[model samples]
Structures are given as structure tokens and as C-alpha cells.
Target chain A: MSETQQPRAEATVTLTNDVGLHARPAVRLTQTAAKFSSRIELALGNQSEWHDAKSVVKVMRLKAKQGSEVRFRAEGDDADAAIRSIVDLVERHFDG
Target chain B: MSDGTVAIGIVSHSPDVARGAAEMVRQMVGTSVDVGWTGGNADGGLGTDAAQILSVIEQIWTPAGVVMLVDLGGAEMNTEAAIEMLPADRQATVRIANAPIVEGAVTSGTMASTGADLEAVVAAAEEFGG
Candidate 1:
């Protein structure tokens, strides 16, 4: 869904780590996203295909390098928390 | 109540190797899983220790069982000995799969975290490769 049209909370963050969303960061993103009750999805660039935020393999497939922008959307009881946690992790570069 | 009981452990000859692989598995599987690992001998040299393997296993053991992924050679031998040291009941709950250490740990951890039974997790690890 478009950012403005999402039925739940959504947020966008730019990956800043030099390594981008590689193995380590991707793992952290998936782990943090999995903690919430929302059904979250992520998208990159102009691709409309959103991947399951909880799947490491799928997140890795995004190949979103540093400076790439990732959009996260979640719909559930805790959609807001899911968006905030994920945005926080991305902003923190997965605490690297 | 039938979910979230399985766990995985990784054994290698180098602590860094085990730690790196464990981190990857934890990332893919999420922190909800118990993906423990150990490497090298007690003296910190290049060798696998049965005691260390046993200790790692015990840390993540569950009634549903634990699956272990070993790097090879001494690691496999030490892991087998570690399992042998466990009591019969605990022994029955553990399984060592013939799978690549990194790939197997990632696969098993992912499967276990999703609520697959021990047998299914072991099968996924084994099936990960040819």
C-alpha cells in the first residue's frame, strides 16, 4: 500500500551503515520486527513488492545498500510499535 | 502449548566461527530462539571439547529436544561424546544432524523458532544440503 494509504502505521528510514542491510543488520532488523504482534512488510526503492519483515532471507533479498530507503508497514494491534521499533533499528544502524 | 520448545547449538574448532554462525542464525530466526554455540578447547586453542559441547547443549536443552550442528572432524567426535554423556532420557531428546554447520544452524534455528518439532528441525537441517 502507498505510504499515505496504508491501513496501519507506517514509516520510512534510510539505511546508513556502510554495509547496508547485509547479513548482520538484516538479522537484527528481522529480529526486532518479529517482536511485535503486527503483520509487517517492507519495501525498497521503486519496487512495489513488499517482503515479510520477519523473514531474514527475504530482507536480504532486498539488497538495499547504504543510502537506500526502506519503507515499513504494519497492520495489527501493535502496528505502531512495530513501525517504531523497526524505524529505530534502521536509524540506529542495528546498533552497529 | 505445542510450540516454541526446540533449540539449536553450533560447535566449531574456533570460537569466532561459532559465534559468527550463531549470530547469523539468531538473526534469521529472531531472538526468541535459543541458538547457543561453542568452539575450540578449554585452553582456547584449535580443538573441540566434549565438555564444552555438553555445556552448550545443556544451556539450550528442552523437553521438545535440541539439535546440534557441528563443523566436522574433532567437532563431530566431541559432540557425539557429549551426547553420549547425557542421561538416557536427555540423550533421546537430542539429535546431531549431518549438515553443514552454518547452513544447518540457520535452517534448524529458523525451523525451531517457527514451532517445528525437534524431528522436523533436524530434518530441515539435514535437508538443507544434498
Candidate 2:
């Protein structure tokens, strides 16, 4: 038997920002992730380990450089919105 | 607007470092969280001054509490001394995180901006492990 799962969303976005996922971008990502109640996780490229999107320290430690692909996976009621925000933030170069 | 959030204090041996860290926090975390910083010796040299630290603590003191990040052992000691100088009641609300000054302040400020309490903010900073 298959168990029911909560709402989830996933997306992989390229880091187009000049600094990649450095301090400023990491801060923006974590702050955006915190706005949603969903549990959001981020991974670099094809890495198996996922870091909490709302954790600045963990997000920064990912060390995802420019042109790297960052995958976002969020689970919860607002998972879709969380993923959208993260993808948008990355696409916008984290300027917002 | 600053209510219900822990404040962040940055202490460094050089005044420039303290100011720059605080500025970075402000730029990254926005103005949602309060950030105060103090550095340099009493004579404007490169050292930590407990008196300066105490003033910044008092400036940013809130019921939510304040998390301090220090650059070196001297800064930590000075920050501790400054906290000790606070009234007994206020003293309990301040903490010195064992983390790098810039990273700790930024993390603490970001956590605090999310309405995190003192303990969580301190943990976020200390997670850097100096």
C-alpha cells in the first residue's frame, strides 16, 4: 500500500547572480524561505544532501557557485508557492 | 516594529570592523531587526572596550534580548564584562556568541528578523563555531 504524502514542489534553477549563492544571496534566499510555513530544502546540482532553505548558515555552506544548478524542494501546504518564490528569486538574480 | 525580535550586537577589535559588520547585517537582513555595534579601545586604537560594548548593548536592548558576536578573545571578554555591567535583570538577557563576528552577526540578524527569540538567535550564531 502506498502512503499519502503532503503537498510538495520541486524546481532546479541556475544561479545567475555574479556572486552565486554567497552571503547576500544566501540571506535573501533564507529570508524568502522563512516567509512560508512550508519546509523548504535546497541542494547543489545533483548532491544528495539537502540544506534547510530557511537556514542562512546551511544555505551558505552549500557553496553553490555561479552557473551552478540549485534544486529546491519544499513540502507543506504552501510548498508550491515556496518553490515558486525560490525559483523566481534565483531567476531574478536575487535582486528582490 | 522592532518588538518581539532579538537584537544583534557586533563587537570587534577595530571600530571599522564593527561598523562594517553592522552595516552588512542591515543591508542583508533589512531594518526589521535592530543591530548595534561597538569596537576599538577607549583611545581609538585597535582593541575592545567594555565601556563601549556596554553602551551599544544598552542602545539596542530589548525584552526579546540581544545576541553579541565578537571578533576575538579580547572582544569576547570585553563583551562579557559589558554584559556584566548591566543591571542584574538586564544582564540575563544578553549573550556573547562564540562565532566569527561577520558571519555570526549576519546569521543572528537574519534569524532575529524572522521573529526568532534570543535562544534561537544565539544558536544560529554559535552554529558558526568561530
Candidate 3:
């Protein structure tokens, strides 16, 4: 889907907390992304696997497991801010 | 209560997990289910406020009794705490439980929606529980 879209950057945010990327954080990230219209992909640490951020099911299947760093990229008019917002959210443990 | 045994909702910090569990139940019971969730704040942990949980109960819970599957326990713990502070009436109508928030909710939701009785619902939950 990124084949034709606005500028996008892959920002990697490490899962610093003990909980890992568990369901709570994943749901928050997915919910936050649902607020915008864009193609969002979440990649697990150093893995080629990336799932659509909009689909809560697909993201959960990634099994982000704790301590897994996720690289998020948003493709859209507000891709930059969307990516930053998600990065900040992940950094914050979806609000701990 | 349930046209089946019980109605179950996975009240956790993660909406995806809740929805995932709901998805599983929908497949099992082959019907839609009532659902709710919260968990976005960093320090917020994985629990919604008791007030929010009540809102879900009022808004989503239906004829069959509902089983609340919370994640953690103790004072102020996520879903666990939320379930505790429920009023006498709400508590009477709902059953609070602990298990794999996702898998348990799905199984319970499916069984509950299918008109399974409380014992049968609890049994299904215990059958494939974490």
C-alpha cells in the first residue's frame, strides 16, 4: 500500500517496560491509529514481520511479546504526526 | 438470563485483546456479542475505571447474565478492581472472574450468548482456561 503515498519514515521504539507489547498496548496503538486514515504497519524487533496497525487481530498475531522493539510507519497526509504519536504512545507503554 | 448459559465480556486494558476474544466467541457461538475495553494511559495499566466498566455493563450487557473477565487483581488493579467496586445490583447481575482475559472471554461469551446456563458457562471457561 506504500507503493504510492506521501513521505513516510520507519521509527523504531523499544518496549522498555516489563509488560512487553502485550494486548493492552497493542489495542491502544491500534485504537490510536484508527483515528486517522493511513496505511500503518507495525514491525517487530529486527524482524521482517509487519502487520497492519488498523486491524487489531493482525497486530495481535504479530505476538509483539514484551521487550520487542516495534518500528511503525504511517503513510498519509499526517503520516509524520501519526507516526510520532504512536511512537510516543509505545514509549509510554500506552500510558503504563 | 442468557438465552444460553451466560454473556461474557473481556474487560481489560487492551481493546484488541477484548475484541480478539470476542471474535473467537462469535465464531464459537456463531453470533454477535456485547463488548467493552480500555487501556491507553502509560500508568493507567490495563484496567478501566469502575465507572467506565459500569457504563459498559449498562450499555452492552443484555438479557443473559454477564461474566466479567478481568486481567489483574488487588486494590485498584485493572479489570479486577473495576469489577470489585460495582454496586450491589450490578454485582448481583454480573459475575467477576479471573483467567486468560482473551481466551476465557471468548469461550464464555460464546457459551453465554448461546443461552448456556451459569454452571455450563463457568465449566466452559474452566475447560480451556489459562
Question: Cα lDDT of all candidates, in order?
Answer: 0.82, 0.90, 0.62
Cα lDDT tens digits, model 1, B1-130, are 2745688889999999999999887666577678889998989898899998999999999888899999979999999999999988899888998899887787667667666688877886786564
List of chain B TM-scores, one per candidate: 0.95, 0.94, 0.69
Off by over 4 Å in 2: A1-4, B1-3
Number of the top-ranking candidate, with TM-score as the measure: 2
Give per-residue CA lDDT, model 3, range A1-96, as digits (tens).
Answer: 455648676688888767765555555665567666678898888888777775544565677766777888888877888888888787787782
Return the lDDT, model 3, position B57: 62
Error of 3 at A16 (Å): 46
C-alpha-based local distance difference test score of model 2: 0.90
Pairwise DockQ winner, candidates 2 and 3: 2
- Runs of candidate 1 with Cα error greater than 4 angstroms are A1-7, B1-7, B13-55, B63-65, B73-85, B88-99, B103-130
lDDT: the better of candidates 2 and 3: 2
- Across B43-113, the per-residue lDDT of candidate 3 in tens digits comes to 55654566666666666555566677766542125444455666656566566654577666655554454
Candidate 2, residues A1-96, lDDT tens digits: the string is 998898999999989889999998998998899889999999989889888988899988888899999889999999999999889899899996
Residues A1-96 of candidate 1: C-alpha lDDT, one tens digit per residue:
646543489988888888888866876776677677689999996679998877666776688999998888999888998898888888887883
Isolated chain A TM-score, each model: 0.89, 0.95, 0.85
**Candidates 2 and 3: which is better by TM-score?**
2
For each candidate, what TM-score against the reference? Answer: 0.64, 0.91, 0.45
